[model samples]
Target: MPTALTAPAAGAVPPDASPDVTGSDAALRRYLHGLPGVDAVGLEARAATLGTRSIKTSAKAYALDLAISMIDLTTLEGADTPGKVRSLCAKGANPDPTDRTTPRVAAICVYPDMVPVAREALAGTGIAVASVATAFPAGRAGLEVKLADTREAVAAGADEIDMVIDRGAFLAGRYLQVYEEIRAVREACARPDGSAAHLKVIFENGELATYDNIRRASWLAMLAGAHFIKTSTGKVAVNATLPNTLLMLEAVRDFRAATGRQVGVKPAGGIRTTKDALKYLVVVNETAGEDWLTPEWFRFGASSLLNDLLMQRQKLRTGSYSGPDYVTVD
Candidate 1:
């Protein structure tokens, strides 16, 4: 069984760490650049090896259900309507209407304007409502706009906020600016009741252009009080890949070891099948241990991925494949 993490506050720095690490731009830069470099060849090889490991029938059943529960069913299109959000919410609440035994998804992710719709539709369902803020796919807006976006979502009953970091600032070596932006956005996720919404910081790793940059971005976001460090916004040409997701699993594992604070990881975009999702789950188990095997610590930010999981699940139960119509069209 998967266990919950009882750790310090999200913003709490490591007890034994130096204050200088996040004290200034130069310190943060030195710390980030000082970290060990990623071996591209070795990372790809290891991910490939893990992807080849097969699971038995019983374990496969458990994994399919787990994967279903870990999904963040999403719809972030410009033409998204309230009806669409509600339909997506219904699908998330009961992935396969024919099988009440099917697990509910972790969350329903949508644009800020659709938060109320999702929240109302998922009421009493225990499914989280996650809104993409901070200018979403492109973090190009000013800080004030970003904060307002976050506050609006929280005010409208969003349980989580997915914020995008300014990749331009990050690449320009303005590390502290990016850090402070994340910190400010984290502060804006607070609800009226004093409890804050969980913050997932998106790095858009494809724009980052290097494995080392991805590592630095992961640590930088975690240090700035991110509840989850995500790989992409799912809008980039390069979304989630096995090797990059593996690298992120390693980051969360090491971060918990260093700070005694566990942060979740979400690999968004391009993950579309039960086979692909299983590969990610295998890497999570092997890299981060069984502790992160739950929906609380790991998530798949996907839309169509749910349909495939439900189809495979039906196959496992009935010993035959279900047609595409077996699942709802998202």
Candidate 2:
């Protein structure tokens, strides 16, 4: 069994950090700009190198199961229905019904209005209900509206809130605005019992336009109390990539080293194959160490990826491909 390390409590700050770093816009800008620049070629090279690593057959089975457990089985669509969410919830709880021993997913991600349905369906399953809020895929709403969105989800029994930052503000260098918005959303995640839903700040990395910007966004979100810094909304043209996910993993690893606060990293979007999932697991283990190997500190924001993982898992078990028909259609 993997020993779980407790991440820094939500909203906890580094003991020796300077107050001025997050105190003012000028200070935040200077701090973010001062951080080391990314070496694009080197980063891509390293990610590609890590992706090529091969695990033994026994290790591959374990990796497949771990990858399945880390998925935030999701359904975010205009056409989503109650029955669809219920089906997704059932799939999340029992990924491979034939085996009866498959692990449940980390969470069931849906829109705010679908939270109640998901919560009800996932009851007693020990799986989290994660809702995408703040005008998901685009953080274009006012703070009040965003907070209301977050609070509504929490009230609806969401265990986690995946909120998008104002990419417009972030791109314009309005660092403090983005930081304050995240803090407000974090507060809004609070329930009547006082325990707050975990907040995952999505950066939508593609629009950010540069590795440096993504790194800055990662640090900024972490500074403002993000429990997880995610890459992409999976709605954009360019979503999660090996280089981008690698960058986020490096950010979380360094953040923990500096603040004793272990933040999680979620790579959402285009990852869909068993091979792709295994590559990410390698990157996480190699870049962030084994402390982040569990579902508590890492997750794959994917839907179709689950089916592929299941098929591959069955193949490993029986020495023959089960084909697409072996898994349920997503």
Candidate 3:
């Protein structure tokens, strides 16, 4: 029986600080429980329909550029070193060194400790430095440790803080604990100037295992003040998929319609090729509309996908087949 904290109103200027939480555990649980259950068969069918869309050559070229810009060029490995982070930043700032026309990625995501290294590497570029916090990939730490992880990243100059929700709590039906953790992390994202670090809440939907849990987690994250609802940590067996991502898009769309606050979506892991990336764009285009097509509202959390995109771009321009040797692997 946890109590709701007073947070900033929904869609307020400062994304992090306080959340516009619904109510007590009972009320919030009741509200979430009452939301429409997902139709798995119908959802899969719709996703399949969207996946089959044929993008013209010209449109695909446009989508390739757009997809590159919307990437949260990520490196979240335990073996991640400063050299590795700098290399990733270089690639993110300029994917194709040969072509100056190539747009930079939206941001460079790294571990909290490496925020400074990434920040230094990406300095003066419009590309942002994002850090994964909340004992990332596990979300098993206590709330204080999680908040400290987030605060340290922000203090180290991370422009964005990607936090993981306590899936254990959510799965156990302790929704209030999960909700309060997001609210607290949102508060930690606040800067001294009244601005807040952008917060992206990761549900690790692979671990959640069902479309219904994914939908519920999506709403919970949005309601508790997530600036973006990310699909996975890219660490589990079942990372981002077409159906799961499509369901997330639907959640963001419905949330915006219901509350007038727009939240972004990021689909990470297993989206390795240009075709898979384009299918996601199609989902965003049709489900969330053109407004969400921009990087401000959409992102792909990937590492190898960029190299593939660069190779494809080269082929599109040179009118010849390209190989892995043509692109730099970050």
Record all residue pairs in model 1 with backbone atoms less than 3 Å apart, i.e. clashing: none
Clash number for model 1?
0
Q: Which rank order by lDDT, best down to worst?
A: 2, 1, 3
- Candidate 1: Cα lDDT at 314: 94
The predicted structure with the larger lDDT, 1 or 3, is 1
lDDT of each: 0.89, 0.90, 0.88
- Writing each residue's lDDT as its tens digit, candidate 3 over 1-330 gives 334433324333222222365677776666566566778999999999999998999787899999999999999888999999999999898899899999999999999999999999999999999999999989989999999999999999999999999988998888878988999999999989888899999999988988879987888888788999998999999899999999999888877876788999999989999999999999999999998999999999999999889888899999986899888866
Better of 2 and 3 by lDDT: 2
lDDT tens readout by residue for model 1, 1-330: 212222223334233322114656776776677667889999999999999999888799999999999999999999999999999999999999888999999999999999999989999999999999999999899999999999999999999999999999999999999989999999999877789999999999899999989988988888788999899999979999989989888888888887788999999999999999999999999999999999999999999999999999999999899879878998
Task: Itemize residue pairs with steric clashes in candidate 2.
Answer: none
In model 3, the runs with Cα more than 4 Å from the true position are: 1-19
TM-score of each: 0.94, 0.94, 0.94
